[model samples]
Every structure is written in structure tokens, then in C-alpha cells.
Target: MPQPHQADGPAQHAAGRQLPAPRTPSPRDAPPLNWGVIAPGGIAGSFVDALHTHTEQRVVAVGSRDPERARAFADRFGIPAAYGSYAEVLDDQRVDIVYIASPHSAHFAHALQAIEAGRHVLVEKAFTRNAREAERLIEAAGERGVFLMEAMWTRFLPHIDVVRQVLDSGLLGEVRTVAADHGQFMNPDAAHRLFAPELAGGALLDLGVYPVSFASMVLGPFASLTAVGEKAFTGVDGQASIVVTNESGAHGVLNTTLFARTPTTASISGTHARLEIEGDFYAPATVRLISREREVLDSYVPAQREGGLCYEAAEAARCVAAGRLESDLMPLDETLRVMRALDEIRRDLGVAYPGE
Candidate 1:
């Protein structure tokens, strides 16, 4: 297993005993690759900035429907190429991989385009509008023998690796529950993408994916789930609560909302110990391991990155260099499973995207 990156500051502990430090690699340690970014959206900007600031990976090109926007993004990021269209980016023979930063509705088409063009892809999350689309992309990538992975960057963070190590060590002892929430207040204007049906807008697909993916990470796929939600005036889900039970009887409680900001924290509790991830848990944050008796066993504070999105980019570069088709840390199967769960949640909430 890849060790976690060392913590930023000196290790802090209880009772004057230092806890173990994470051993994940620094971004500078990842193999470099030439990248082409699609959409050049907010998230893409963050990704490019993190790569430039921390990793050896280079954003060679940027593409957008608007040529001027493409050029601006490229100029801002110091990219060498700016294409007027996504097709041109895919056609760039020098581009080793394409990062699809398009909206959820366009993920399938964009990813399929990259696969057919013989380019590896790292599609931003939600993976797709639904599971069917996710499956199609996975199958296409498999047939093309090119790499494809969802940019679930959280899974690749150093603190996440530490969580994995703790879980694998059986320190948690029969994990019983996973709880997480992600919510952000958004403008309720019907024209906004977050509430626009044509864009596949909804709290479930946007803010909800984090908690859902977190639950999936802690407790595999759910065997059954029950959900309840309130819809926004614009006909999208404004808030939702979900309870999922896996085959092993482990339960996950998840909630997401666009109506208000939430604590955005997460916890995994087992018979013997529990791990608590601090607020904004999906980002670069802290984790605490505590015993059933409520004593702090250890605490992990991760080194901060500009945006922490480079971790997934680095993983993608490593996998492509190794001729691998997918990442073990965030596999295609897991992406598909999470999509299925999202689909179920939408069904229970009676929220359907256009043409779904």
C-alpha cells in the first residue's frame, strides 16, 4: 500500500505520547504527465492550480466551447495550448490524458469522446447523471483499453489513506455505522444550474455525492436504502436524508442539502473504536481515532495542499504510466455502485432529471 504523506506540523497526542504520522507521498513525488482540461470550470481551475503548485503534472492544453474562454484559462494556468472545442483537445496527440470537468449531464458524452479518441480520462464526480451512463463509459473504456477513473479526489487524499490503514488494521473492530453530511447554501434562482432540470440540477447530485461516496468507502455497497427529501421550488431536491444498510448489517446515515450549510463532518463507528473526521471532512482535514471508552487513541492532521485536488491527478498519472486501466483506490465498479445509490435516492425523492 502507498503510505500517506507525512503530516505538516509535529504530531500531536494525548498523555504526551506521539501518534503515528501518515506516510503518503508528496505531490512532487508522483510521476508527471501532460494533461488537457475540458470545460475549464471552477473545479478545473483548482485542479490545474494544485498540479502546477505541487505536482510535476502539466496542463498542456485547455478546451471550451468558447475559444476566448479556453485561451483565458490556458493563459491563466500557463498552459501551452488552447482549443476552441473539446474535440480538438481530444485530437491533440501530445495530450496524454483529458480531465472532463464538464457538468454531470455531459460526463457520459465527454468521457466517451476521450475514450474513442484513444485518450485516458479522469471525469469529475457524480461520475455521470446516472448509473447507466457510468456503465456505458466504463464498458467503452474497457474496450478501448484506456484508463478511466472518476475524479473522486477525496479518496486519494493522505488522511483518507490513513483512514484506510486504520480500517484494514481492524482497529475499528466490526464497523457498524457510517455517518456523513455535505450541504451548501445556494441561490435558489430557477435559472441557476443547481436548480435547473436541464442541467440535471439537484442537491442530491451535487452536494450529496460527497456523503454518498464517503458512506460507500466505509461500508461497501448498500443492500438496501430508504430516503426522504423535500424538493426546491424549482423542482429539484433541496434537501435529503438517506439510510443505507449493507450485506454485513453495517448502516450508513447520510444527508445533503442546498438550503443551508451543514457541518460537513463524517464519522465511522465500530464496536471497538470510532474515527471522526473534522468539518469539511471531504477536503484536507483532520481525523481522530477514539476508543469505545471515549479515549482519544490518536489524531491525524494532514499537510495542506493549495486545493488538494492534485492527489487524484497524481494517481491518474501513475496508473497511466503503469498501463493500468483504472484506479484501485477509486475503481470504476465503486463509481458505478455510487451512481446506482444516487439513482435510488433520486427515485425515493421523486426527483428526475430531464429525459431520465
Candidate 2:
């Protein structure tokens, strides 16, 4: 472990320095692409809405298992095509990319379908059921030479860009700890996806991913971790608390649960200063930089809020236009590392999905 820096007057005065500004470009500046939506659920609606509101990208087609659902979604969003099966979305010639907003268990299959159809893919977060599934999708996308990314929207937000700049500038000195938690009180009905084993549902995959990925961004890959969890009535993980250590010995303390509402805040503590984020840290929230003596140095608040998801869409559009196969901001390798960490956490918690 690296030794902590001794507090010096100059170092203490460092907090008075100006913080870096976000360099994220405007969503409207990216090249437009026609997008297809598979599994037109609530998240897909939000994504399409964001794109339509903030970017030039078009949602040309939508697909759902229920024909009515598909048509309804398409009509609601002014989409041109609606199909009864997800395969139709993948097969649509007009779609340059397909967004997979299916449930956890369906991500691998839906993304693979899009890849096989030669469409770029953006799978929503908790990218897949496990690391193995994540690896398979990445390898498939690579073999096909198509763009693939996990819709970790937080990574693309302007505030997050500011966080990235701060970390890279070494303004915080050596980071020693990261702490984040996300919890939501959910209806525990067995049929709801959150409590369903068949759908690979759990608090860890749905709610925990934010904190885990945030820690990964701040502390690099996890080297080792200790996890303990409780099960809901439906035999799925209800809550989990984890302490992860990175290769540099920095620690991440994380927690997630479906039984209660948490502050949903996050923080990074380093030798010289600390960065703190407001509740719903994974979304467009305020970020604060503070000295070790607890003086606020600076803070950041977004100028826009309603369509924050457009940032990720803009990134996807930019990468596709540049012919890049994956985003440097949310690389496939990091997705896999985070998945492996989640897998280990689930393993230690004795949580397993029905169909693997």
C-alpha cells in the first residue's frame, strides 16, 4: 500500500484551486443513426424519449413479444415500424443499431441476435446474467466487427466527465476508498422481475450495479472482495453488502437492497481531498470537491436533466460514426471485469439464476 501524504500548508491550500470543467460534447453534435428497440419496455421508452428529445438519432423500429405492445410503443414514440418479434427488429434493414432493453436473462440472447443480424448493439446495464454471458457477447461483437456497448449511462454524463478529469489530474492525490450505495423499496410480488429467479432478478444485478461500476471507475478492477447477502421471499438476493479491494489496496464499500430506500449517494476519499456525489449518483446529480479539513472547494451541477440518457446515445452515435467497435468510456473489458466481480459476489452469496 502507498503511504498517505502528510498534510502540508501548500497541499491544504490545493483545495482553493479551480476544478476541471466537463469536456463532454453536445448530444446534438453527433452523427445521426437509425436505432431499433428490442423489448419495448419502460427503460426502452425512456431511452427513445431521450434520443428523440436531445439527439438527431431516430428510433425507426420497435419490437416486443406482444404485437400490441410493440405497436403501442412505436405509435407513442412516432416510430415507423412495429414488429411482433424481437427478431424483426434485428432483421430490419433500416436499423443501424439495436438497443437491447430486455430483462437480465434475455440480454445475452437478444444482443447475440442483433449481432448475428449485423447490427450494432447497446445492451442495458448489468450487461448480462454473468461474466460468461458478457464474454460471449463481446467476442461475438468482435468477430462480427460491430460496435457494442453496455448502456452505462452514468459514464457518459457530463458530471462524470468532470469526475474523470479530476481523477486523471491527480487533484485528489492517492485514492484510498470509494463508497456508494443504491437501494429501492420494491414490491416483492413473486411475479415482478425484481424477485424472479427465472428472469435472473436480484437486488445485486439491478440496484447494485451502479455502485459496483462506480467503484470500478474510481478504483480500477476489483482484486478481492468479501460479500454477505440476504434472500428475499422469492429465493433471490434481497440485499448485499460488499467490501472490495483493488490491486492498489484501495477499498470500495458498497451496498444495495430492494427492501428499503437508501441515500443512493457516492464518495471518493483520497489522501488530499475527497469527491462527493448527491443521491442518485449514477444519474445527473451534483458533484462536490472538498478538502480533507471538510471545506468545500468546488461543486458541479448539470445544466440539463430530463434527457440525460441522450449522452450515452450520443457516445454510441459518435463511436459508430468513427467506426470504433466499443466506447473507451465504457469498454467491453471493464464491463467484463465488473461482471466477474458481480459473479463472485453472487457466488459468495449463494445466489444462482434458474437457467445459468
Reference-based TM-score of each model: 0.94, 0.96
Write out the backbone clash pairs for model 2. Answer: none
Candidate 2 residues 1-356, lDDT tens each?
Answer: 32333444685445335567799999999999999999998899999999999999999999999999999999999999999999888788999999999999999999999999999999999999999999999999999999999999999999999889878767788889999999999987988999999999989989999999999999887888899999999989999999999898999999999999999999998887889999989999899998889998899988887888899999999999999999999999999999999999999999999989
Assess each prediction's global lDDT (C-alpha) against the native: 0.88, 0.92
Error of 2 at 95 (Å): 0.4
Residue-level lDDT of model 1, residues 93-123, one tens digit each, is: 8899999999888989999999999999999
Give stretches of model 2 more than 4 Å off: 1-16
For each of the candidates, the C-alpha root-mean-square deviation to the true structure, in angstroms, is 4.8, 2.3
| Deviation from native of the Cα of residue 220 in model 1, angstroms | 1.0
Name the TM-score of candidate 2: 0.96
